[model samples]
Structure formats: structure tokens, C-alpha cells
Target: MRIGITYTILRREELEIKERAGDFGEVFMLHEDDMVFPSNLDLDVVIIRNVGHFKALYLARLFESEGIPVVNPFTVMLEAGDKLLATLRLKDRVPVPDWRAGVSEKASEKAVEELGYPVVLKPVFGSWGRLLAKVNDRDALEAVLEHRKWLRNPLYGIHYVQKFVEKPGRDIRSYVIGGEFVTAIYRYSEHWITNTARGGKAEPCYDEEVRELSLRAWEAFGEGALAIDIFEGSEGLLVNEVNPNMEFKNAARVTGVDIAKKLVEYALEVAKA
Candidate 1:
């Protein structure tokens, strides 16, 4: 079976992912501009790197309409991609960090009251530490909004706000596949954002609670390959977000889980049906 894998041209690791894809089947790397596929040649599945990119998202839609399987279906990624929606989905399953929608100036104020002061405002759709700021008071919050408007950032209008958990820059990342635990890690940084993209370092963590939360999130997503981000605070462990298209290189390194083989095996099984 032939399969397609994608990563943004901006991300330097796209080639590395292609090398791994070779082991499963015929692998082709695509740039957004060069991404057209022939309908005549049937492909079994497409493994997307970042569904946030238009090229990859469009390809997912194409594969879905043609009845070709998408790893972590376009539907699941589309739903979970929205950070606000992802948080809400975990409400009953796990205790989530306090969050709110800053749809307008007044809405931001209301969310602040509901969630309390020293809250964090982030773009509803964002990754890494892009366009994020902590708003401790009304003035600071309004200033951030104005600054974004002055810079012509379109998302300045309305966004999401969450209560800032006090921690010394540490968090947990756990991987799950078909509702089974793969592995986990402790990501640490001196800054507010703990993304490996933001220079966070990975350390080993094999806590049982980490395993439990990871499985709960996987079950919440109806069992797909996923990464669940969690935070340890004074209130104990709380879920952060789930990204089906999450990066795996570091998680694999720290946890010693061979995620590539596992993902390919599951994708082929689902595609065969």
C-alpha cells in the first residue's frame, strides 16, 4: 500500500519524518504548492503532520471524501484542534485548568471575573507560544488587545483565557494509542510556555497518574493515537490539551516508546477496513 505523510515546509524535520515513513510503505513528501494527487492511483492512508496547515487540512478533507483513511480522522483533529473545544470536552472526564472565551472586550472582563485574576489569554487556534500573553488586570488585558490590533493581528478581536497555574515551568506529556499507554515525559522550562518548540527540555516520568490521565483522554477521543498535555499544580494534576497531530520525536526519545511502528500498524488496520 502507498501512503502520504506531510509536515510544514517551515519545520526542518519534514525530511526526517519521510525517512521513517519509508519503513511502512512507499512514502512521498509534499509541499503545499506541489500537493495534488492523481485520483487514478489508489492510496491506502495519509498521515498528516500538522492539520493546522491549510495544505495538510485540505488533504485530509480530500482523503475523507474519497474514502481513504486519515490517521486520527480529519473529524477528530478538526474538533480537537480548537483549544477551547478540547478543554470543554474534558470537563466531565478530568479536572481541566480554568478557561474562558474572550470573544470581546467585555467578554474578556467577564471571563476574568469567572476565572479570576492573573489569567492567560491565548488564541483559540494556536500552537507553541505564538500570540500568547498573561493578563493580570483589566488595563493589561486591554493593552494586549490594542497591541495586537495595532500590529494587524486578526485574532486580536476575541480569544480564549485560562487561569494561570502557578508552577516553576514544568508539565507532563503522555502518549496513548487505541486507549493504551505508550509512554510519557516531564517537560521543563524557565518560561511560561513549556513547548519543546519553545526550548523546553524533556525528562523521564513514569507516574501511574500520568498513565491514568492519558488513558482517560484517549477514551474521551474514542481511542486514537493522541498526546495528552497535563499540568501539575497545587490542586494536583489537571489536563491541559489533547493534540492528535502532536509531535512525537521527543516523547519517543524520553519514554522509549516506538510510536512510529505503533501508529503505522493502527493506520493500516483501520485503512484495510
Candidate 2:
């Protein structure tokens, strides 16, 4: 099958996914890296790798409108793109991070009054530790929200305000595809966030319990696979975020899964239907 995979940034995960699909035949790595396709080439499947950027969003639309079978669809991408929306949909099902979305000024004050200080402030749509902040006091939270409101950035407004879970500052990235967890990796960081893009180290986690939570997260999405992140601690697991078109390389080696093979099989299965 002819498959076209888009890469917004040449992260190691994107590169490896391209290489893994090589065994499946005609795995085109679509990039501005001078990638060229035949003018009339017919791609059976187009995989949109979410780079958590507007460009990927635009290009994904282009392919979807062209009637190409886009994995995870544009709607799925957009749904998973917004943390606030995902959080609302996933609450109580997966121990979703104690989050409140689209809060009014009065509501924010009330929630903060009840939930206490030191909640997390995140842009509704963000990835890899970019533009995520923690607010420790009402003054700081209100100031940040005011600035973001004036700037019309939905990062603070129309976003998620989550209760902070003290984890010694580490999180887990559970890579899922095809209704199973390909692997689990602990992203350790002294800093608050453990995004690989932000200098976090990835470590292997083979705990079957973690793997089960990971699959449950994907299943919770209803259809299509997703990468489920978790903030784990003595209290147990709290769902961090869900990425429909997830990046997976640190996870592949850590869990010892041949990610390429597994992903190709998933694509073929999806295409068959």
C-alpha cells in the first residue's frame, strides 16, 4: 500500500515511524525536506503526525478534503488538540487530571477558592511542554488570565485549570496504537514538565498495570488509537493528556516494541475496513 506520512518537525519518533513503514512498502516521508511526490501519485493512506502546530492542522485538512484516508481524521486531531475538551470528555473514566474547562471569572474564583492554590494553567491546545504554566496564587492566576484574555490567547481562557499533583515532578507517556500499549516510558524531570522537547529523559517502564491503564485510555477515546499520558504517584494514576496522532520513539525502545511493524499493521487493518 502507498502511505504518505507527514512530519512537521523531524523529531526522532517521526523519523523512526517513517523508517518502520519502509518494510511495508512505499512509506513516503512527506516533509519540506525536499520531499517530492509524483504529480498524480495515488496514496492509499495518509498519516498525519501531530506536531502540535497550526501547519499540521492546515495540511491535515487539505488531505481530508482530498478524500484520502487520513488516519485519526481532522476532527480527531482537533478534538485531541484541545486539552480542555479532552479533559471534559475523559473525566471520571480514567482518573482525568482534576480539571475544569471554560471557566467564567466567577467560576474560576470559586474553583480556585475550593480547589486551593497552585493549580496548573495550560493552553487548550499545546504539546511537549510549550506554554504550560503553574499559578500558585489568585493574583498570579488572574494576572495571567487577564493578559491572555487581552491577547485573545485561549491558553488561559477557555482552557484547563487542573489541580496540581505533586509527583516529585515526573510523568509517564504511554504509547498506544491498535487497541494496545506499544510501550510505556517514564519521563523524569526535576522541572515541572517532562516533555522530550524540553530536555526530559525517557526511561523504560514494563509494569503491566501501567500498560492496562494505557489501553483503557485509548479505548476511552471510542475509536482509533491514542497515546495516553499519566501522572503517577503514591495516590496512583491520573490521566494527563491524550494525543490521537502520537509520536513514539522513546516508547518503542523502552518497551521493546517494534513500533514500525505494529504501526504498519494498524494502518493496514484500518485500510482494510
Candidate 3:
């Protein structure tokens, strides 16, 4: 079987996948910069690693059009890649953070008023906690919204506001592969945002609630490898966010699991079926 791994910027996870994939089948590295509509799509399966690149999605859809199996199918990517869509899809199925979407500053402020102070404002399409803001008061909310209004990208106009849950300065990052819990890590930070990309430290976690919630969240998205971020609320674990293009290098180091290998094995299984 011919397997292809698509990436924009090479990372440790991609490098590790390339190294370990030789044992399963022939591995090809698909660079995003050089991707073109090939005359003949030859790969049996493709694992998309470029999380935020539109080109990767285009290629994945092209491959799917030719009957090639793309891991974490473009359909899943479309749903999971957008914060508003994911929240709407998982509503009532999982305990997602209370959120409201708006296109104007007045609507955003109204959402803040309804949700209360210190709401989290996030871009509709982004990852790694980039462009996330916490509005502590009406003035701060207005200021942030005013700044966003001038940005050229119309995406900034679409405000995705959520109620900020009080936590113990930590969150759980759980890995789920093929609808099963693989492993988890505790990301600790002084700030509310505990993403590892922002210098948060990772430690192995063994919480049953986290495991159960992670699996439930994965099932809410149907099938695929997912990284479910859970926040420790007063009641229990709340599903914070679901990442389709999940980064697991830190999770792997803390848990000692070969995540890439498991992903490749799952992809091959899907291809065979």
C-alpha cells in the first residue's frame, strides 16, 4: 500500500511518522508548497498533518474525489476546523462551553452581557489558542471588538464568544484514536489558556472522568483521531474544544505512546476496509 503524509511545516510528529511508517507500507511526504492537482492520484491512503492550511484541505478533497482514502476525512475537517460549527454540532451531545456567535460589535457585547464578564473571544477558524481574548468588562469587550472591526479579514467580524469557566489553572488534553481513548496529559499554566503551544508544561494524567468525556466528545464528531481539551469546572469535566489536526509531540513525551504509529495503523485499517 502506498501511504502519503501531507505537511506544510515539518514538525517532530511528522518526522516521527515518516520514520516509523516504513514498517507499515511505502511512505511519501507530500509538501504543501509543491502540491498540485496530479494527473494520476496514486496513494492508497493519505494522513493530513497540515492543520491550518487551506491547500491541504484542497488536496485532501481532490484525493477523495479520486476514491483515495484521506485520514480524518475532509468532511470531519470542515466540521472540526471551525469553532462555531463544532460547537453547534456538539451541542446537547456533549458538555461544550456555553457560546454565542455574532457579526457585529453590538451583538458580541450583548452576548457578553448574557454570558457575564470575562468572556473568551475567539476567531471562527484558528487553532493553538491564537487570537483568543478574554474580555473582563464591557469596556474591554468594546475595545477588543473595535480593534477587530478594522481588520481586513472578514473572519474577525464574526465573533465567537464563550463563557469563561473558572478552573485551577490547568486543563486536560486527552488523545482519542479511532473512537478509543489513547492517553492524556495535564497542561499547567499560570494563565487561563493552557495550550502547550503557549509554553504550558505537560504532565501525564489518569482521570476516569477525563477518559469518559474524551471518548464521548470523539463520538460526537463521529470517527477520526481527536484531541479533546477538557476544563475542570465546578461540576465536572467540561468539553472545552475538539482539535482535528491535533498536535501530540508533548503528549507522546509525557505518556510514552507512539501516537503516530497508532494513527498509521488506523489509516491502513480504514484503507483495507
Best by lDDT: 3
Weakest 10 consecutive residues of candidate 3 by summed lDDT:
51-60
Q: How does residue 33 of candidate 1 score in lDDT? A: 61
- For candidate 1, write residues 10-122 as lDDT tens digits: 34334555666687789766555665654443678777775463455567787778877877777677656667777777878988888888667677778888998898887
**Poorest 10 consecutive residues of model 1 by lDDT?**
8-17
Q: Is candidate 2 or candidate 3 better by TM-score?
A: 3
In candidate 2, what are the lDDT values of residues 227-272, reduced to their tens digit? Answer: 7888885688888889876777777766677776677678767666
Pairs in clash, predicted candidate 3: none
RMSD of 2: 2.9
Residue 41 local lDDT, model 1:
35
Candidate topping TM-score = 3
Q: Which stretches of candidate 2 lie over 4 Å from their true place?
A: 32-41, 154-156
Candidate 3: list runs displaced more than 4 Å. none
- Compose the digit string of candidate 3's lDDT tens values, residues 1-273: 899898888899999888777888899898877667753758889899885646556766888888888877887777777788788878777888888888887888888888998799998887788879988998888888888877778889888999988889899999988887999999999988899999999999998888888888888888878888889889877888788887999999999998988888888877887
